[model samples]
Target: MPPLPAFNPSTECPPPGRFPLTWDEIESELVKADDFAESSTRSGLLEELRVHFALVEMATGAVGRLWLAGSFVSGKLDPEDIDVTYLIPSDAYVRAMADPDTVDNLDNLGTKDWCVRQGLRVDAYVLRLAATEDFRALGVTGAMAPDDHKVFESLGVYDEVWQRCRSGPNGIPRGTRRGYVEVVL
Candidate 1:
């Protein structure tokens, strides 16, 4: 949470089988949240992910985005398995094969293998530009909405904490308001 330990791009090493990312590369594309908490602990975790996504994007050459999704974003980090979604272009699989050093596809097996090599727990999915039934079911509408970007831009841990710590028993959070965290590229 302590301002995420001043991300030093030079010092960051990519997870196993992944390439390293430079601080400048990530800083150039990094997005800042309008609302950030004073707690360094929470902030550090977020920053770590920012770097991670930057690397993912760099390695894949596919537009990538990260969201606080899952229990952590919903202010329920106690569960330990923080759900995160990494949106990669559908062509990422092809790209991986072409550039083995930077990208590697393990089939439709979600990017968990990659994440595991890096010591992170994640649920990654490749999103295609084409509008398919699966895409529709996932609620992706070709491009990101203004509000959607705003939500990511203004993301913070406040709401999740409030909903969990303040909600009474049997008042579990539900709906799009509580179940998901979205990140787009």
Candidate 2:
């Protein structure tokens, strides 16, 4: 993975796309880089996210990669929360959705609503991948049905959507693009 870029002065966030980082790098860059009042807050949030990630994976068994966005990934001194977008395997999604036990965890991880309800500062979203393999080389294979080709298209849609965010760090809708951090679990 490449080194993360500095935050934009205006958006207080990095440029748009996925910036993959190792577990240690994530802790170092996002948490320890800033020596401020919010350092402890960031540390706590990281731990909370670890537990949440494990719980989600145990329930659905679909988490392949995790992208961090929102204020926590920004230059904010004291962000209220961390935003997570779970990149999951398509087959795992089917299995989890079909399984009866995943309902509660899946339902609770629906969006940012769980943040307020649980008295935590973590938000989540889901983006399913066509396969757990190289996505760049992926396309409509002859073995796939015509309708199923849309799955590949959906990946692009999710990429675009996740790449876009408010231009400002205060959550105002200024329509700016910012990259997210993919934390290695």
Candidate 3:
């Protein structure tokens, strides 16, 4: 891998939507994600969840925390795919979507797009906070398809893995033991 240029944070256009959150706000969400992953891990799922976290951290930038939804988090022992979502700034979303380099890179999110493009089970949505709220409130209204509604309604943040991911003096108690890669901003 080569050293990339510093993120200017000024060269990208925001994606079309509402509820774009700042980087710090997204970190708070990560805490929730850490907890969720911790609570849901069984013998077969922990490594998959950890790998997903590592890949998202390694490949993504300028995004908020990752979300685990669908059958994986809904108590299904064998989920077809690990449905992961990320709350990214609209501008960052636009930049990633347009960049050819980001395509095909799972860590880069090209794999995410490709999975969606092929209608694979690894459901992914890079949405804003407002969009998330709408999904929560509307519960898959008439405007949204039934399958889409199922995915949206499956956002479960409650469970044992709800432990904090942070460590050290400023960290929360019962924090996670699984290793994680911090998302590049």
On lDDT, the candidate that comes out on top is: 2
Off by over 4 Å in 2: 35-40, 132-141, 145-148, 167-175
- Candidate 2 residue-wise lDDT at 71: 80
Q: Which stretches of candidate 3 lie over 4 Å from their true place?
A: 1-41, 106-122, 128-185
**lDDT of each candidate versus the true structure:** 0.40, 0.74, 0.40
Tens-place lDDT digits, model 2, residues 1-185: 66788877667788877898987888788888854445658888888788777777887775878888788888877778888877777778778878776866777875567765775568877666564344444464554533446666776776676677764556646777887788776
Write down the lDDT that model 3 would get.
Answer: 0.40
Determine the C-alpha RMSD for candidate 1 after optimal superposition of all C-alphas: 13.1
With a 3 Å backbone cut-off (N, CA, C), the pairs that clash in candidate 2 are 15-179, 16-179
Please give the ranking of all candidate structures by TM-score, highest first, separated by commas.
Answer: 2, 1, 3
Compute the lDDT of residue 137 as modeled in candidate 3. 49
- 5-96: candidate 3 lDDT, tens digit per residue: 12112211111112223334333433234334554333234344445545544444555655543334322334456555665544454566
TM-scores of all predicted structures: 0.41, 0.81, 0.35
How far does residue 7 in candidate 2 sit from its true spot (Å)? 1.3
Which pairs clash in the backbone of model 1? 1-40, 1-41, 1-42, 2-40, 2-41, 4-44, 9-23
